[model samples]
Target chain A: MSVENFLILGLGWAGIFLPTALGAIGSIVGCARAGQAACGALLDVESGYGRLVGASALPSSQTIYGIVVTMQLNRQVSVEASPGLFALGVLVGLALLCSAVLQGSCVASAINASKSKPEVFGLAIAPAAIVEGFAVFAFIFGLIISGGIPGTLAG
Target chain B: MPTATNYYMLVASLPRMPRTFEVEQVPISRLRLQQRLEMLNEEDTTTVQQMQEFLLWDRQHPDRTDTEVLQEYEQLMQRVRNVLARKIIVYRMDVRTITCGLRRRRLGMDPPSGVGQWVQAIRENWEHPDFRLARQHPWIPLVRGYMEAHQPLQTERQLLLAIWNQWTRLADRYYFSFETILLYLARWEIVDRWTRLNESLGRQHFESLLTEALGEHARFPQ
Candidate 1:
């Protein structure tokens, strides 16, 4: 095979893996941000450390969704699959990345609010959940689009 | 050296301050606030601390002059980078300028324009109630009214409330950022100062009333 075909197939693999890779990147940033707030909140409050840490972990779901979506996108790498793979991978990755980062910010806000006013704890998490819902939308649609891509099923 | 300010942690550690000076005392003490701000690098902490020291009412030593304060304001404006933070410093100076203008005008010290345009405008428009800058600072008329009534305490409270509200708006616009931390410190200082003033004033009021009551009792017909 020519170098052209090899390069094209390589691009296809890159695309197939982008979602998981990008999602993990987003999760790393998101969790770090939320975790910092959690640690800060711990300094001011006596209890509820468990929930703050749990909320910080909320951004990790993007990685889980990414992993599942990656599995669905798994197919025989080809030039034909490359375009579809790259588009799907880059878009989903971007969505997950932004959502996770923003979700982390929302979680941090919730933690900050709750630390001062514990009564608002349950209500504040709603913003982070809404952000997570957007990420889920990206994941669900990515999974659906993966099957429609013109490629032979890996048996 | 601290690599970053860890603004998120710093901001999160601070309590939510009200938009106005409604709190009787600061939610966090100055010492504790300083401790949390220890996260900032030494250089930044020095700058921030220096800036916070400016515009304090009682900070003026007998020898301190207006030129010194104005010079410090310019120096701080150069050192600080954030636009909102810079605006905060300017707002402080504006408050000081307007108050000074009001007092100087009342004292009948009308002179030629020597300072910034705003001061010059205050001088030039001595005849005008708001100095033609009423739109920029709507509270000017209200402050003028208090001054006219010779209610210095009310004027002080109004000025403090205005500053508190400005800091509150800046804090609300930005969160988990460096400027937000600065704004928090500003509000905390206001709260701290308000508490101190209230305490002193309260003591003075109680002492005066007690003395008056005792004097009246002693003078009563026997």
Candidate 2:
């Protein structure tokens, strides 16, 4: 496959997965804070669960997006395609997929934390942002690599 | 059969009890009228004539302590209280039902407006005729008490205490209505109103009364 094909696939994956990963990370932090505060008199355990679930659930949209892009790219590539471009596309897809996984996992962790101390929700945003930043970095890198390849070597 | 003569004698004897004369002492005459009205079961021509004469006398004599007049006023006030209580119950129930319906649809979403609408509705409806009439009945008794106290110059504490006592009486009735509504309605707005009203009257009024009383005492130094 051409460098253009690899870049398109990477962009699509990033577009779908990055948001999901960021949202998941944010949810995780929020849930953790909730858990920490759960011991107090004001803590509402049921509401905490609802909030945690809401936060964690946001990342699933990105996972579905990443999967669709991966399948599309796989169909576009053939055995005769340039190995270099194919390898690049595969690496970009992996990065995007990893980000989604990280987001989902973080969200899950936050949910667990919220169950114990519901008051920690305010502090969860930072870690989620950090994870999001990494996802963005990978996305930009994939886009740049794809853009640099010549058109004739694209497919 | 408590006659009109009995009511006249009761009113005439009021000046004897200096303490009871100041405040409303249950108006036994009016209570008798209410009881008589409730007990009138026969459609006898003589009883109907007596009833008509009683109502006519009540209307013609503005200053008369006729049992029928007092009973009429009592009935009017009772109707007002009932309507206000009913409106409060309906308003609270509607809010609770609507909130529950919304919750079922959204899974656990908090209502965006919170209790703001409920508060506004309550305050607005508070001026309804029924609520107004119910609120007015106690004012007469309060004024009567204050007048009978016959203090040439009232102390600030005395005035504050009197006002606070009246307010507390009114608040008690208001709370009764509120609690009745709350028994069936779980919306935050009703709860918010109860809390806000209690705090406003109880704490805020208490502080203001104390400050005013202290200020007066400082100036007079008695």
Pick by DockQ: which candidate is best? Answer: 1
Off by over 4 Å in 1: A152-155, B111-117, B213-222
Clashing pairs in 1: none
The residue ranges of model 2 lying beyond 4 angstroms of the native Cα positions read A1-44, A48-50, A61-81, A152-155, B1-222
- Residues A41-151 of candidate 2: C-alpha lDDT, one tens digit per residue: 122244544565456554444344434433333323332333434554556545555555566445444443444456775565356556656656755665555444433
Cα deviation at B14, candidate 1, in Å, is 0.8
Share of real interface contacts recovered by each model? 0.44, 0.00
Writing each residue's lDDT as its tens digit, candidate 2 over B43-105 gives 322333333342233126666433554465344334433343333433333333233333332
| Model 1 lDDT on a 0 to 1 scale | 0.82
Worst 10 residues of 2 chain B by lDDT: B12-21
- What DockQ does each listed candidate score? 0.65, 0.00
lDDT of 2 at B186: 20
**What DockQ does candidate 2 have relative to the true complex?**
0.00
* CAPRI rating of model 2: incorrect
